[model samples]
Target: MTYSRSQDSPDRRAEFPQTDLRGSIDGLLNAFYQGTSKEAARYDLTTHEFNLLSACLKRKEECTATELARVLPVDASRISRIVTILVDRGLLKRRRLPSDRRVVMLSLSEEGVELTTRILRRINRNSARLMEGIDEDEIHIFTSVVSRIVTNHDAIQNSE
Candidate 1:
């Protein structure tokens, strides 16, 4: 659905109009990402780097650059560059797989773990502060809606 406002007071108030799902969802998604990126900026982590670290932490096992490329939406070349940089900076380890000498695995270093944990904690605190006044029921509804959208998107991508 679309939310529109008249020329008179478009800045302050908007009229809710019947619109397609695509635009509404796109707008909301963009806004949410912008907000997240802003929050992540405080910890001095580029969005992509934070994402890579977060993915590694979630895996809890040796993850390959290829796997990270598959899990993350970025291009393989970008992942390759990021992985190389992380390895060079001692934030991630690179090793050959015992099963297949041709393959390489990656895991977070101790320093990487510490930094990622600190950044996550900071972000979580910021989110909690931001949500302090919101109603619990509304938060639940919002979460349910976002989760359904993510699930549907994942299913479609997996099928492809």
Candidate 2:
């Protein structure tokens, strides 16, 4: 699908021609979330908790709540609540940074790492199954297009 500016207001309005793209994207997202939710439930986690753990695993270093909030779609308060639950459950560690006593740093606990790894493995397997019939070239093109879409989305958001 292509992006176009609406003649109604070139500066304020954009349009994407009605196509299967929206439906297809929605279907893919729904399927992915359904699979993730099921896998997360196996570990007694909500999808939000699972997402927080996954983000922490990717950081590979202690990070602040602000950093996580930047990456996550949730608000700061929601992030705080999730962090509290994870910390209390022993899946995450929270410590005040020495250089900045007021700032709390977050990291995955050993248990969190293990659980994230297992969940990632399951998710990867599911992804492989989902892409079983697709060729590498097709996958590459799909990823490139998706990246462009994300860039466009960010541009629009920032512009506003």
Candidate 3:
């Protein structure tokens, strides 16, 4: 009288893979995204602001607005606006390059460094929690699939 979930209705697998890999990945991302912005809000930063800072932190040396824009893969104007706001907030510092005054360089402000460090730590903790139940092998496979999908998307974008 009682049927297991899979035994009840498993025929969809014939048409759609049981894993529904892309959908599964998208669902996981959507679910995680719901809570992630809330986490950034705790520090008064929108998720996008946090991401912009995170990109700046990737380089050891001061990076130009153009550089951040390229790595962020956003329009130069967008990065310029974001950088200007962060600078006014004292979360970032911008200066003219000593050797080339026309070129501007940017680095995290002392406070920016502190804030980004805390934000990255929190994100890493969340990431670890998400992976908690999965074994190492499962994680490797999951990462591989995600990587391949990302590469494919990038290739498709480049083609356009």
Candidate 4:
């Protein structure tokens, strides 16, 4: 689960749907995520692990476990488990943050970076294929609709 910073934008949030937005959204995601997972398998990476590694690569330094949990939309305990696996696989290094000893920081290993880069490239190519025949305007409209839902969901979460 890569953390999308765009999720914080009011224009990109979403509310609970009175219609079947959930189904539509899930279907869209499942198709893409499933394909991405198959591509990741060649590198022995789980879908979630690949996503987390990619997110870590976007940063200049290690991220604390709490940050991963919050940003990835996973519960803290689950994030902890995932981090442990990543570390055991030599894909990540876990250490105490210099500023806060209580926080565990995560950073990728050299091999981890290479592996993730490959996976990202493959996934990007696969996604491009899916959008190949679609017009740019259509893609823009689709993305815009999804952005609105994200904004509504953010509003719902904030109110709660």
Which candidate leads the pack in lDDT? 2
lDDT of each: 0.78, 0.89, 0.79, 0.80
TM-score of each model, in listed order? 0.75, 0.88, 0.79, 0.80
Q: What is the C-alpha RMSD of each candidate to the true structure, in Å?
A: 4.7, 6.3, 5.1, 8.7
Q: Which order, best to worst by TM-score?
A: 2, 4, 3, 1
Best-to-worst lDDT order: 2, 4, 3, 1
- 12-102, model 4: which lDDT tens digit per residue? 4444333245555666788898988998788887777777888899886888877776778678887778888889999899888688888
Question: What's the C-alpha lDDT at position 89 in model 3?
Answer: 88
Residues 13-79, candidate 1, lDDT per residue (tens digit)?
Answer: 3453323345566776666566567755776667787789889988999888889998898999999
lDDT of 3 at 27: 70
Q: What's the CA error at residue 57 for candidate 3, in Å? A: 1.5
| lDDT (10s digit) by residue, model 2, range 1-160 | 4333333353343354333576578778888999999999999999999999999999999998889999998999999999999999999999997888999999999999999999999988897888889999999999999999999999999999
Q: How much does candidate 4 score in TM-score? A: 0.80
In candidate 2, list every pair of residues with a backbone clash.
none
Deviation (Å) of 67 in candidate 2: 0.7
| Model 3 agreement with the true structure over 1-160: per-residue lDDT tens digits | 4323355346765566645554566678776775567677898887767777888787867989888877775789878888888898899899997799999989998899889888788777887888788999998987898798789988998999
Model 1 TM-score relative to the real fold: 0.75
Candidate whose TM-score is highest: 2
